[model samples]
Target chain A: MIRLHLPQPLSAGAALVPSLDQSRYLTQVMRLKLGDAVLVFNGQDGEWRCVLSDILKKGVVLKAEAQVRPQTIGPDVHLLMAVVKKSAMEFAVEKATELGVRHIRPMLTARTQGHHLRLDRLDAIAIESAEQTGRMDLPVIDDPAKLADVLEGWDPGRRLMFCDETGGAPVVKALSALEDSGRPWAILIGPEGGFSPQERERLRALPFTTAVSLGPRVLRADTAAVAALTLWQAAVGDWER
Target chain B: MIRLHLPQPLSAGAALVPSLDQSRYLTQVMRLKLGDAVLVFNGQDGEWRCVLSDILKKGVVLKAEAQVRPQTIGPDVHLLMAVVKKSAMEFAVEKATELGVRHIRPMLTARTQGHHLRLDRLDAIAIESAEQTGRMDLPVIDDPAKLADVLEGWDPGRRLMFCDETGGAPVVKALSALEDSGRPWAILIGPEGGFSPQERERLRALPFTTAVSLGPRVLRADTAAVAALTLWQAAVGDWER
Candidate 1:
């Protein structure tokens, strides 16, 4: 069954209007006809089984038949990644969504290259990944912010898993030490050029930040995100279940 | 420091010549003058510090100064991934190299999309990733082979970690049980359409194969490769070192 992420509230027998793009996908691309069954969900509501009710000039309406699954969120893992190239940044967002990240915060560090990021495009990628990956909720993509500012407003209660390239304890060891903490966590990945001296010092000095190395190799920013997230999931997240 | 993957043996005071593309990257892209220092490595030999010795029209010559690091190989993990789309397949090769897979064998399955893969392109991607990620060696990219043939000729001593979409034991749990068995391993990732019913049944019935689920959500082939490799590394590979 095709899964669609609709923002509108859903309930049994509720008529929901899909977006223009989604309408084209359903009517033209997928060739789904009236009364065809489709799965739909909003971030707030659980997944629902719906049937195509009517076709309009601009869009189509879907009628929710029954709630198939209750809403559930994954671990509170935020990705504080530095802004990389456009392709790499987009790739990070898509993979993070599939890996069950809750939030993506693009950080602007001293070594980060200057580039304009289209938040709408990133949001679209996140939604598509979530829909395809059987995720019940979409990750919140935040606008790019300065790394200093993000750290300044950080919650001390949340442990920060900093992926340092220079040298640090291995990720498995670092995560093993935190196995009993049970605190919410976020992962920080630097840009291709890596973190500047000041940025590295600041991150290391933070009380809540724990520096962890992915391995001996220096992975690209996008690969680091996936590897770090995978380690987190295996060690502390829901992968144990 | 710039890193180059050279196939020639390296030693103190050994003179070497680079390929045409590498010369272009050094002269035009990086704008390096003669006598500039760069790091060079071959799969068999350790990394060496070298200096530009000569500049030709098509290639450049370098003189090795000393061995910087000794050759080291990662775990004996082979990736037997079904051939996916061109971009996704290339991405998997790159990430697998960065994540320290010793070998990559592209497999053809019933549900795999038909496409021509340029082995040269994949080798280049692997070399570039290894060069950038501090890897001492490059992974061998095998020609696409039938999944059945690969499985039939498989070594019974090596365990096969199968990422099954239908469901199985969680990855961490499955890997934990293999902690005592120090055998070589291979990971099998299916295509985007997933494994055929026959393929799934055959894989599950194999005694050497251990089916593992990444998580609750379904991951794209590329993400699955990264996540699966990361999990394996954390549980039993060199990350524990």
Candidate 2:
């Protein structure tokens, strides 16, 4: 069954009109006719089974039949990635959603090249990823912010996993050393040029930061994001469950 | 200092010429002058420092200076990935190299879409990644083969990590149960639609296979490849060193 993400509240027997793009996808592209079944989920609501109730000039209307799955969010981890090239940045967002990140923040550091971000475009990608991955909720893509500002406004309660390109403790060992406190966590990945010397020094001096090395090889910014998230989930998050 | 992967042998006082693409990159793109320093590495030889000795109409020549870093190979692991779409296939190759895979074999599974494999293009991506990642060796991209045939001639001595998308033991626990056999290993990732039910049955019944699950989410082939490689490295490979 095809899955679609909707923003409206969902309930049994509710008539919901999909957005323009999604309507075309169901009617023209997928050629789904009236009475065809589809799965729809809003971030707030659980996944629900729906059927095409009407095909009109505006769009296709779906009638919710029953609730299929209750809403369930994954780990409480967040990712703060420095702006990279367009493709790499987009790829990181999609993979982060699939890997169960709750929020993604585009950060700026001293060495990070300034790049314009299209938040709407990233939100669409996240929605599509959530739908495809059977995720009940979407990962929020926060507004781009400078690293200093992000750290300054940081909630000290949330532990941050800093993926330092420079040498640090092994991830498994470092993560294993800290018993799971079930605290909200975040991961920070630097740009391709990496964090400047001053930024690295400050990050290392931070109290809530846990600096760890991914491996010996120099990984791209996007690769580092996925790797760090995987390690965090495996070590202390919900992978074992 | 810029680095390039060259096929020729490297030694002090040996004059070597770069290929046309590399020559353009060095001269036109990077705008290098005579005596510009570059680091070159061949799979067999350790990394060497070289300087542009001459600039000719055809290309620029470099004379090897001295050895910088001794050659060291990462884990003896291989990746046998099902052929995905063009962009995803290329992305997998690049990520596999960056993750320190020793070799990559593109396989045709039951559900795999029959996409033409461009060995040359993938090789170029792998080379560029190796150069960027400071890898001493280049991971060989093998000719495309059928999964059944590849398994028929399988070497039982090497363990196979089958990333079963249809649920298996958690990767951390499964990989940990085996006490670092230090034996050769390979990872098998299925295509987008996942392995056929028959294929899954056959894989799960294999004796030397260790079936593992990445997480609850539906991971794309490329994401699974990176996640599996990272977990294997952290668990048994040389991430600590």
Candidate 1 residue lDDT tens string, A121-226:
9999999999998899999999899999989999999999999988778777678777743579999999998999898999999999989877777789999999
In order, what is each prediction's RMSD in angstroms?
2.1, 1.4
- Give one digit per residue, the lDDT tens place, for model 1 in B1-241: 9999999989899999989989999989998898999999999889999999899876999999999999998889999989999999999999999999999999999999898999999999999999988899999999999999989998898999999988889787678777833579999999988999999999999999999988777899989999999888877787767
In angstroms, give how far residue A50 of model 1 lies from its true place.
Answer: 2.6
Model 2 agreement with the true structure over B1-241: per-residue lDDT tens digits: 8999999999889999899889999999999999999999998789999999999989999999999999888989999999999888899999989999999999999998879889999999999999998899999999989999998899998899999887889887788678664678999999999999998898889888999988888888988899999999988777866
Record all residue pairs in model 1 with backbone atoms less than 3 Å apart, i.e. clashing.
Answer: none
Model 2 iRMS: 1.1
Candidate 1 deviant stretches above 4 angstroms? A180-182, B180-182
DockQ of each: 0.69, 0.74
